[model samples]
Target: MVKLSLCAIVKDEEACIGRCLDSVKEVVDEIVILDTGSRDRTVEIARDYGAQIEHYQWNDDFAAARNAALQYVTGDWVLVLDADEILHPEIVPQLQEAIASDRHLAINLVRQEIGAKQSPYSLVSRLFRPLPGIQFSRPYHALIDDSVTEFMAQQPDRWDIGYLSSVAIVHDGYRPEAIAARDKLSRIRKAMERYLSEHPDDAYTCSKLGALYVQNGEIEAGLKLLRKGLKQEKHLDRLLRYELHYHAGIALSKQQKVGKAKSHYEAAIALNILPALKIGAYNNLGNLYMQTGDLTGAIAAYERVWQIDPNLPIAHFNLGLALKEKGKLNEAIAAYHHAIELDPTYAEAYQNIAVILLKNGKVFESLDHFRKAIALYERRDSPAGSELRSTLKEMGFKI
Candidate 1:
């Protein structure tokens, strides 16, 4: 069996560092952590796990940090993991077996992006032989160096790089809400500053920079950058174009450029089958129509979301609201019910259904759902629950 070295670079990751180590502690022969100036007890916690810790200075380059971490690998193979990622228990055995095989030089594992989708999935190279000359590339979206490809090309007999379906890194990297978006924006800001400085005329860089701007709440700047990027790229990257168009629509709608936003949304939908992007585009279009007092158009857009993905709770819930505003009480109730079925834990859907029932003079049914929603929200201490409780009492609810 090939010995595995689990390598990671971290800084001030005390909150999630332990969980990350615990998941793969038993699977690897050695754990190496490269800390870049952590003010927190990130180093102390890592040391408690028996991890060999090394310190590196922050260089504003992810590849530099990653390569620094790689230098400590004493095992035959290296498994790259982040401080917020964990290998699922079922995936551990598969990774062990894959590395043991002489036929395989690398394994591409799935990195599930949580909360982005009802169920999200993405793949990346996470395991590889730590042989001489194998290095990582790219400063921001760091990719494995071309050396691995060149090695395989020369060997010709090396037909062994494979994707492991059973192996996945359960990424909690985007969870708990407080830091996920903030961290992403922070990194984007750094990357943008570097990328723009080096490649001023690069359209892709501009587009990504624009996305970061939008994410950071600079909507006007984001729109300008994205439009400039779009002009340069034309229609080369359809999915990216779709994304830019969608965000442009959102920013425009927020700026009250409703007509321009509508055109962008329509263009995005007319293009292709990027499910997440399409869903977002349609959902935003529905919102735009609702704001313009076009309840019928809003309902139409939302219904398209249902046609695309029936189990999506947000689309169903929003569709129900649009229908309710149009006075289609029966259909609205049905949509709400469907939303509830898709996500029984969804408090907002339950509350909305209760409101619809109360409006229709079904006070008893409304009271029951309101109580249930309150209970659900209380369990999580959601701020939305407090308002729900207030509304329930106003409708003559006992508690």
Candidate 2:
């Protein structure tokens, strides 16, 4: 029975820290939190969970703060987690069982970006043994030292790191406006500045920095770094290529290089990597065609997704929109209906169908759909329902 130390470093995470700690409290032996000047109630919430808290000074060095937190771990194995991350309740026993078994030294629990369902973006080193030499490296995006990397590489077969299927780390890092796209870019730039200063020729850092630039709306600079990284690195990671192509496509599209953007998007789809990545590529293609006033092309791209996954409500909704734009009102209505069938709680599809009904002079039917949409949206606590309700009222529909 191997004991576990769940370690984390956080700052100003009052909105979500309690949720994170609560999720994994029962699974670990000790909870160690390193706070870096949080003015919010993050520290108080952590205290409520009986977490051992230590104040770490703000130094723009993540690895340093994390290493300091590691010193408090009494467990043989350490489990690292971010402030906004939580493990799914069902997989708790599976994780404990894995740690107890004599199969592997470390386990790579899939880090899933929330709202994306089961699509895991990265295999973060979340669980590992607390060996003396297994020190972390890199100041910003630091990972375990080269010795661990080399050890893993040497015994690729025997030095096993099993990926637990039933387990997942759901990260809600993108939930708030403070940590959204713009803010993400700002943090990435700071991290990139430190990383690039030390390792100028590193492909991973270059690719990541390029992606940050793209998110920040620096199209030319982003393209320059991506292209340079692709050209300079001989054997680029295929996974990295998927992200590079996706971001590069967005940059090209922003630059009005529609043809080039489409080419990159096509290349991404051709990779046949993760299904989420495939869906993203197809969505981008639909968007590109929508921007170009090629309604038929947009419909075709979205429709392709339906063939691959008919139950995907977003695909059906997007297809309906494209069809409606092309004046295929009957087909569009059918598409929206399919979307609603796929997801009974899909407010957007109901609203879209209502709009189409109103356009076709079916005022009574439109009112009914709008009511349904409003009901679903309100139940889900969405602001969009207010506008929908107002529209219904203005149209003389009895609420």
Candidate 3:
């Protein structure tokens, strides 16, 4: 039997710690909770789950607290998780079998940080590992991949890393409500800015800070940092360099700089990083091409996205728009229907379809779809609903 230690560094996680523990209690042999001065009942909740608790003072450094919990891990392998994350209940036996087989010293499991049940993005990494010499580094957004790689290089016999695609950990820590409640983004930027002040040329640090700035609506400032980071050659983390380029391209696209955005997207795509990110770059590149009146280029880019994941409503809807612009109404309508099938409440798809119907003189069907689109938009209190309502009144429809 393989010993697996579930290690976590938590603060005030009263609302979510129990669910986090309950989800993994059956999977781990030992639970080690290191609290960094929680004013709530976070420690009490962990104690109910039979966790060995330790307390550490808040030092404003995440890596220091993480390393403290690591010292108490007695198992051969450590699975690090956050209080706002939950392991899929069904993946436990699979996890046990994988670790027992000892096929790899490190495992990359899917970490899905869900925005909603409908749209969840995934990140996979070496979250489950044997911490022989690897310790989380940096103060704010800490990382351990470099140290892990260095450790694995010396242990040639166990240099292999396994991937568990089925075992997903759902992280709810970065939800908008959660971030606003704690003013988390401001604090994150503070720590990241401090790190970059000392190591200005560090690609990964600049990339991360750039991304946060873009998220907070600082376009020019974020783009400058990302472009500068891309030119730097000091960091051994080539994979993160690709991520920075992707973000830089996004910032450019957001500012409607099509040519520059296309260049960076092309650069990131060429690196062939993760499949999802690869498709994302292509999708955004396609949108840029479409915006620049390159319908052929847009179609090709959207086709690539559909090839990777055919059910993405945004890709299908975009493909429909591009097809409609190219004078392929039948195919456009088909694509729109496909998009609607994937997501029933796709208001844009309904509105687009209704516009096409009106163009074709299908009055009754068009009115029906217009009503659906209006209902959806009105529920969200957006400008589209008002415009549609005004259009209907102009067309002599009863209010």
Candidate 4:
């Protein structure tokens, strides 16, 4: 039995601290929280869960706050989590077993971004032994990877890094609403820009900030940073390389440089990385193929996506589109049904199914699906609802 501690840095996280604490209370032997000037009941909530709370001055640097929290951890292993994240219950036993191993100095846990549509899963080095040499780095996206690498380099064969394939944490911070509430975009940009100023050639920061730039509609600047990141041959790790190429592909695609984007996507997909991590590149590549009228390529890419993660509704929906375009009506309908099965409220899938049903002369069945889709779309205030209503009217139906 190994002692596991939960360490976190929080400020004004009253709404989510209790949820975060509850998820790990049964698993961790100790709870250490570093409060960085919380003006709310964050400390009070944490105290209810028996968290050892310490006050620290608010600093813009996340790594500084994280490192400060680490000093208070007494347990042999630390499980780092954010206030907006909860440990998945199913991964607890596996996590315990991994941490108990004498050979593993650190364990990387897979995190599922709750509200993100693309690249929903990510790997985070959250579980590790609290060794003196192991500390966090980077200001915005703080991580212990650099320190862990440095420590491992000293005794390359003495310790091993472990990984859990199952999702360990469910993070809610990436949601659109959450991002808006936290003003995360501007805050992260400011921090990363400052960090990049100091370390211009940092590939990790380049990948992250470059992606942020692309998302903010600064495609040319984003491409410049992404290409700069690719040029850093020595500092590029497998994950960083994948991100650089993936983001470069996104930027290139936005510019309508389909050929370059396809090449970059191929490069990203070719990387010896986790198949789940390549989902975004594959999905985007599939879309590109669809744009170029390469239905076969599009179908293959989408099928690959669903095979990697069957639960992804978008993959099935995209596959349905490709199959529909390829004249495989039955297969298309089946794919649409899979998408609906994964996400019952998927209005677009229902609409597509209705279109296919009508094409096959199943008028009444098509109308039923159209009604469902229209009702769902109207509830979401989507313009598709009115468009669908008009389409039905033109077809001599009054629903």
Candidate 5:
């Protein structure tokens, strides 16, 4: 059996360290943690799992902390994770097999970002051999890609990079509540801004920092940085390039530059990347098409979204709207039903269905759906609930 080691750098992560360790304790042969000034029981929790802990100074550098953790790893392979992430149980066997392979030096694991509605899945190169030349880079959002690339170039025939399609890690650090608690946005922005000043041409940093600017409502600055990143297009990998274009599309759409936004969306979709990663671009493009009265294009994009991930309620709901606009009442109702099946509390889906039913003379069925929608809306304290009640009452409908 191939021995695997878990490496992590944490500070004040007492709340989630135990959960992270628990998920991988059975699979990993050794646990190594580098603590950078934790005032809580984070080190104590890690010790309970028999982790080899090392104390390091807080330098505000994620890559430095991660590399420090690698020093204590003695296993044949290393699996890097954060305190807020858990190794998915289903990927245990897959992970073991991948690391055991002779041809693979590193594997890109799929990570599901919890609470992220726009882009939930991402690829992270967190599994690799602890080679001398392979270390992490970037001050924030640190990754080993740069070092791995260098190492691969130095020894071209040594090993190749591999990927696992199934989600290997579930990360909750991006959740709204988690972000608020940690104030991650402000910290990340400071780190990236400082790094970008020193390395302005760095496409990866540009892409990330640009997106952060857009999220912070600094659209002009975000577009400027994203465009700067695009100027170095030849140096970017498929993933970085896709992100740049996707983010540019978002920033442009916010400015109401529809033509430019569509172009960027198309560029992102045309990239040689995973279809799952293109869901945001496809969905946004569909919305633009819908706004421009392009029913065919809207329907096609929404259908593509459905094909990529049928479990998404929003995809089904969006398709229903496009179908409704196209005057396909039956098809629209069916799509809305699919949305409701996926999410029972989807008030908009119920209300839309009710409207269609009422238009078709199915008064009783419409009333039932409307009541369900109103109850759900009221639960969320939405004004739509009272508005619908008033409209129904004005129509002489008895409750």
Candidate 6:
């Protein structure tokens, strides 16, 4: 029987701590918390869950705090978790089996962030054996498995780190409501500023900071920083290079620098980034070509997205728009149907298809679709629905 220890570091996590603990309390042998000066009921809630709590002084170093927590874990295997995440109940058996296996040294757990697909999701190394040499590094966004890699480098046979398909953790720390509650965007900017000041040549940090600025609506500042980071492309890893170009492309588009923006989008595509990001870049390029009156280029770009991911509604909708503009009526209608298949409640798609049908003398069927779109839109009180209804009434069609 292998004992598993659940370890976490938290501060002011009152709103989420209980939920985190309740989800995992059934599986672990012991629970430990390292409180970094929490001024809330976090400690109290942790205590209720039989978690051994110890206070650690805040040193602006995540790795230090995490390493300190490692000292208290007595179990044969350790599982790292945060206050805003939960171990999925479905994964409990997989976790237990992993620890019981004597062959594995480390386990890469799946972290499914809500609302995002797992493309290029680097398996977060959260489960590991408590070896003497293993510890964490980095001041922020701490590298939890750094010491494991170093220890494995000498004895390659001992490097049995692998991913588990059965277990997945749901993390909600990046939720919009959570971000708004903690002023997370403001904190990210401040942290990035400090990180960049100390490590000016770190292109990945520059990429993150640049993207942060763009998200905060500082478009020019974001573009400037991203462009500067792009100059050190050799220093950037593959994903960060993709992200830098992607952020800069978005900012350029906002500034109406279409040609420059298109180049950056194309560059991100060339980098072979995450599949979701690649699809997004293609869609942006497609939209850019459409806006610039290059119908042929737009069609090609949208075709790339369709080939990559036919399930994405936006890609189909955009393809429909381009096909319609190209006067390919049957293809346009098929594309719109594809969009509707992916998103059955898409009123705009219904509206568009209805208009096309009405123009093609399919009056009764077209009127039925128009009514369906209007019903859904009116339920939501959308302006587009009202305007569409007004147009139908003016055309002498009874609704």
The 10-residue segment with the lowest total lDDT in model 2? 114-123
- Candidate 1 local lDDT, 55-119, one digit each (tens): 99988888788888899999998989988888888887677777878888788786766665422
Model 5, 215-307: lDDT tens digits are 999999999999999998887899999999999999999999999999999999999988888888999999999988999999999999999
Among these predictions, the greatest TM-score belongs to 4
The residue-by-residue lDDT of candidate 4 on 1-399, one tens digit each, is 689999999989999999999999999999999999999999999999999999899768999989999999999999999999999999998998998899999999999998877688888999999999799988899999999999999999999999999889999999888999989999899989999999998889999999999999999999999999999845677888999999999999999999999999999999998898899999999999999999999999999999999999999999999999999999999999999999999999999999999989999999999999999999989899999999889979999
Per-residue lDDT for 1-399 in model 2, tens only? Answer: 678889999988888888898888888889999999999999999999999999989787777788888888899788898888997788788888777766566776756565542122455667877766566766655666354666767667666666575436878775445467437656658877688878877766777788778867877888888887777544765656776777778789888999999998887777745454466678888989998999988998898777756766778889998999999999998999998898898888898898898898998898889889999999988988988788667877776
Assess candidate 6 and give its TM-score to the true structure.
Answer: 0.71
C-alpha RMSD for every candidate = 5.1, 4.5, 3.0, 1.4, 2.2, 4.9
Q: Best lDDT goes to which candidate?
A: 4
Q: Give the count of colliding residue pairs in each prediction.
A: 0, 0, 0, 0, 0, 0
TM-score winner between candidates 3 and 5: 5
Q: Which residue pairs come into collision in candidate 3? A: none
User: How many Å off is the CA of 306 in candidate 1?
Assistant: 7.5
Ranking by lDDT: 4, 5, 6, 3, 1, 2
Q: How accurate locally is residue 26 in candidate 6, as Cα lDDT from 0 to 100?
A: 89
lDDT of 6: 0.82
- Arranged by TM-score, best first: 4, 5, 3, 2, 1, 6
For model 3, residues 269-291, the per-residue Cα lDDT tens digits are 78744565466687778888888
Computed on alpha carbons, the lDDT of every model, listed in order, comes to 0.79, 0.78, 0.81, 0.94, 0.93, 0.82
Return the clash pairs for model 6, or none.
none
True-structure lDDT of candidate 5:
0.93
